[model samples]
Target: MTWRRALSVALALALALLLLLVVYDRPLRLMPWRKRSAQPEAAERRTNRGPALATLGRGKGDGVDLFKGEPLLGEEHIFFVETSCALDKPQHVPYDSESGLRLSPRGACAVEAAAAAHPTHRVYLVHTCDVHRRSLAKDAAPAYALAALSIPNVRLWAVPYALHFVGTPLQGWLASGALRASRWPVVHASDVLRFLLLWKYGGTYLDLDVLMLRSLGEKKNFGCAESPAAVSVGAFNFALDDPGRRVANACIAELLDYRPDLWSYNGPGAITRALKKVCDVQEVLEMTEEMCGGFRLLSTSTFYAIPWQNWNLFFTEESSEEIMMMIGKNLAVHVWNALSHNTTIYTSSEQPYAQIARRVCPNVVAAVGDTM
Candidate 1:
């Protein structure tokens, strides 16, 4: 009778302990070795929560730690620069109030397509904002940015001009407010920053409007020709330590004499001028390695498959199949957002742009829905 009473008391105490553990939300491990088994459950919870935004980094003098704790920048880095500070009020695409300071649906699709195409590369979406001041909370960030950030290899960063341009020749030009003198300050600023970014980082820099169709693969130190005589600055790659960075160095140096009145002069014109200094501009049509001192000039079809003159073809239902076939072999397709900004994209429509968005950046397409 005494032994039976003792056993009952022990059972009652165990039940109370189990109840307390449940109330406190602590798992009860009956065996100490089972603690190791719980690790998988914890890991699964983290996996379900998705990756945290990789915007955390300390700004060093003259340069930035783009991704503080992540892997270092190697050849596997792809860059997309967003110079527009009016992200919340996008001028090009339909604005959604719920998205909060995110890129337009089209812009986000460009980035997500790049990330999805090259899963191994760390795709960085760098914004030209003052990094020290602007830190976007997860809930407050727009859906496009959040959706892009959800990709495992994608990272978002806000870069300050002072930090990024410190050691370069553009430092003086920027400090003197020469950039403000431009008729199109934002466009000109984008031109200046792209040159500086490539010179300093030596990786691929893509415009927010360019959609990726394939991996760039070992191709470095190259630019796609927008025409027989002009090189498109929208998509270009240069190595950081490529023995003096001839083209990049030349472009940065030319920016000091930047002309504000002429629109394309500072953007496409700058690269065209730089290539001339390195190699014969006429040879660019041949795309020979020796033509530009080992710089490969890709054909226009590689990027600008749909010429700006026919930019509306992307939106027109009639040109959808023709445009798709044109860009089938190309590495990417430039949506020509500059000309197509006013053109509306009907999600339900069979336009090539909408179809590409659905195929490449489905997450963004789904998030924005029929509004895009």
Candidate 2:
């Protein structure tokens, strides 16, 4: 009788242990720490595969190529905007196609320089006009744009304004046709688009004329001051996360009081006004990152090392070595294309612009042999 009782006790202990294991298995696997630990590994895998392009939205019959995978936009992107009719109508400038408008050599040089300077970051050449891939075939697209696109990190894309402005504060204003009625339609449109782009998909925005001199590094949510008093929207950075979104939202909101008749009202003016909402504009000049809620204001040397008033310096024959020394620590040089568009750059000439092009955008310099 004692031996039989011992056998029953052993069997009961085994059954109780098995029941506990069965009950805890699923819950243990579903713990919060397990999911938290998996996120970093997944992100690492995506980064190792290199940057990929994804289609955001496309209309019927739109010839834009849909890349089909990866995130649409992120902190790793650097964007350049082309808002003029230059994509469809010839600007009679260097690299302009006889059949249609194409990217200018200077523009291509800008894109190339950015890609070369920041190999890890993806550079996007965004056009406000409709772009058909068929239109970008060998004969239609200029050699400069083609050469720039050959770089692994450079991409050309056309995004619709309506799609970009959808959920933002600019949506109702854009839908009202106020943009069409503006005296400076192209200028105002460019301003509106920049703010909207930053608001939706945060990243660095550079005017097509801005040339990158070095890696932008991990700088996020910042703008360059054109002078001691005001910030320039020509080159700015806004991250894709929460902090960036807040400042971008403020800039978009300022557009509600858009001034169509004023030239700088929407572009530089909007950004300055937006900053005023959070802090004293004068304090921004002091270079404090915490001034406007983590928004840093870089000095004039960073982007506008050569101001627009001195735009002629780029084309004039000067000491290339001295110019380089002046802007050596500068992250970029804004060529002030708005004021310097009429000026011509020749390969045979040894001007500051030509010299910089040879070093930064050698491929473009080689493509457009004599002039740019």
Candidate 3:
């Protein structure tokens, strides 16, 4: 009787094991523990990888990196320049705009959106401040993990570190006898890097201060007009291997030979000057909404609805609803931090900046303990 009972138990166990193996060998997984982590695995991959090597213009002589695999250039990308202070932690905390770019709260939201916006496209936040940057606040790296989320499509490109041992396009300009570092602000470095990225890797370049309310729809090669006919360099995109890259190349060349003429000499001014020759339009105001030399020209109302001079309206405004309604057909809005840096983003009560900040970078706001 005892031997029969033990044989029965062994047979039952063998049957269960055979059934499990058969189920697993079929279509569906037999065990829940064996389920694959698709999203988390992809996010992990994104954290490790950097930008796809720009193959078109950046030949061996142009200083392209040797090891990084050239991901398809046809793949879409959204690039942002953030030369942030290393100590600026808790990225959502409100610091003086005059201090630097909105690296925390605003930047966190912008990067999150840009990465998630185009599900397939890659987003690069170029941290170009290698060493010379001054620390404005405390450690923001921990809080940044929240903003960055497990964004599989986003990459934080530390420019100097990435190109440390490799040859880069900028080395020529840096090595040139005429180049002077004295006149260049670290901010100007942003401009130089922006132009270089656009020229090398065909994609859109956005300012860290800009925010997008929607995904970057269908990608195209284009620049937004700040006013009626004046194009702003703040938001622009290009198709891979587009001829428009030449315009960016010319701008970088001018940036190499830069002088402090106009405040925006290295930025908008350089872009406008290049477009004037290519667009063949004598009056910038005369430039229409249509394509200019195979490039889409977006109007200010479609992008920069508020002028830089009127930046105060964003802060003092009483109602967030009224301001949102006024955004109209804009693809995105430029915060114009350069003018509004000193303006307070928070107030005793609900202010426009706070409302916007809460909606976009909620994680940051919560981390910083901002009153809702």
lDDT values, one for every candidate: 0.70, 0.72, 0.57
Runs of candidate 2 with Cα error greater than 4 angstroms are 1-75, 85-101, 280-287
Write down the lDDT that model 1 would get.
0.70
Q: Name the regions of candidate 1 deviating beyond 4 angstroms.
A: 1-75, 86-102, 130-135, 241-244, 280-287
Which candidate ranks first by TM-score, i.e. highest?
2
lDDT of 1 by residue, 16-134 (tens): 99988787664443322223222233211221111222233223332222232212434477887766642222233333333234467788888899999999888877765433223
Deviating ranges (above 4 Å) for candidate 3: 1-72, 84-102, 130-146, 161-170, 177-184, 288-291, 347-349
TM for candidate 3 is: 0.67
What would the per-residue lDDT of candidate 3 be over residues 1-372, giving only the tens digit for each residue?
A: 699999999999999999988877845533332233343333232222233222111223432121122223555778887643222231233532432323555666667656655677777766643321122122223344334533557655543423421255566655553223434344555666677677766788888778766666875767777865456788887555444665666566667656544457777777776677666666566554352556767667666776787677667656566777777545677788778766666623456666666655555566555432
lDDT of 3: 0.57
* lDDT, model 2: 0.72
lDDT digits (tens) for residues 1-372 of candidate 2: 699999999999999999999999878755331232233334322221122233322234433333222225553878877766522332233534542435778899999999999998778776655555444543366666667866877766554445556556777997887776677776777787877767766888888898888888888898988877677899898786665777788788889998878889898888887787755554446646766778888877988887788788888776666776777878889998878887889976778898888888999889888988
TM-score of each: 0.76, 0.77, 0.67
Each model's RMSD to truth, in Å?
15.5, 12.9, 16.8
Compare candidates 2 and 3 on TM-score and give the better one: 2
Pick the lDDT winner.
2
Error of 3 at 187 (Å): 1.9
lDDT of 1 at 311: 85
